[model samples]
Target: MATFETEFLFVYGTLMSGVDNQWSLRLWRACGQPSEAKVPGRLYTLGGYPGMKDPLDGEAAWVHGQLAQLPDSPALLADLDAYEGDEFVRLRRTATLRDGRIVPVQVYMYQPEVDENQRIWSGRFTFAQ
Candidate 1:
């Protein structure tokens, strides 16, 4: 398993800022502010939420999200891991900020089988209100 070397986390779904979910609120409270960032991947609509996966060959799309600095707390990490459940796995990846600077961040990648038709071409996910 890979260990998280940086305190940054990239969230692309309901966990992104402005979402009213309980975990999103908790994460915002603990991680302070967030900045617009994107990772090289594809976003898909997984029911009410969204999932991210590696981009297809020669694909230049990016999964748009917010990057936040997590506090140094193991309990918080454990809680996030539990919230993600078995359908997602955390991995380290590079995120490109709006200003074009690349950063290392930990992100949850979708693990279950995906239906290609559910792909979100916009790359940015918005939870329906």
Candidate 2:
């Protein structure tokens, strides 16, 4: 029965819940609880964090993560973009929600080519505690 603002985002790495760069929680909190979603892409390890490489080849591969319905805050988006830096580029893409709804969201994609060994075979990436 709660209505949330519609600037959604898909986060799979540090920006995810309970990760190191959780400073983004301020933005996440403004959005409300994140829901599980899947996007077309592959997850790869980039040193200490993970990155998403969108195949753009339809849904052949999928990267699993949470979809956060963020508020339309320019400052917050700018902060996130700056935090992601040049390694990740933000893009708008469709994601399949847990309940089978497909919606467009802002996704930070990894822009570098990675070795096959660096890839996460499960399509899901998380920090090992």
Candidate 3:
């Protein structure tokens, strides 16, 4: 199984504010320096949900999310898969944030390319917005 080395996940999706969501507080007990803040990357709305894309790409946009210093990224990725209905796949990617710092981040990608009409978004993000 592919595992991620970082604890921070750049969530630019429904997991943000308003829409509806949150990680278990129990899980947060072990979650580290999520306190380290960085508005790193651009957010885009696909369908109705947010998509964290490449900042270099002119098409990229940004939204709000959080920098969670999770201790276990692989487990977190698993939880994310389930949270996203077991279909969302995590891809290890690099993102350059609005602050000009580059960091290695994990992004979850949902397959089959959901259409705009079917996409549901929270509008407020924890990362890019």
Per candidate, the number of residue pairs that clash is 0, 0, 16
Best by lDDT: 1
Candidates in order, TM-scores: namely: 0.95, 0.87, 0.56
Model 3 alpha-carbon miss at residue 106, Å: 0.8
Query: How high is the CA lDDT of each candidate model?
Result: 0.91, 0.80, 0.51
Q: Which residue pairs in candidate 1 have backbone atoms (N, alpha carbon, C) closer than 3 angstroms, thus clashing?
A: none
TM-score (C-alpha) between model 3 and the true structure = 0.56
True lDDT of residue 106, candidate 2: 84
**Looking at candidate 1, what is the lDDT of residue 108?**
95
Question: Residues 14-101, candidate 3, lDDT per residue (tens digit)?
Answer: 6532334465443354554343333334444554455543344553334345455557546656766677664456767654555766
Give candidate 1's error at residue 44 in angstroms. 0.6
Model 1 lDDT, residue 128, Cα? 61
- In candidate 2, position 111 carries an lDDT of 85
Span of ten consecutive residues with least summed lDDT in model 2: 1-10
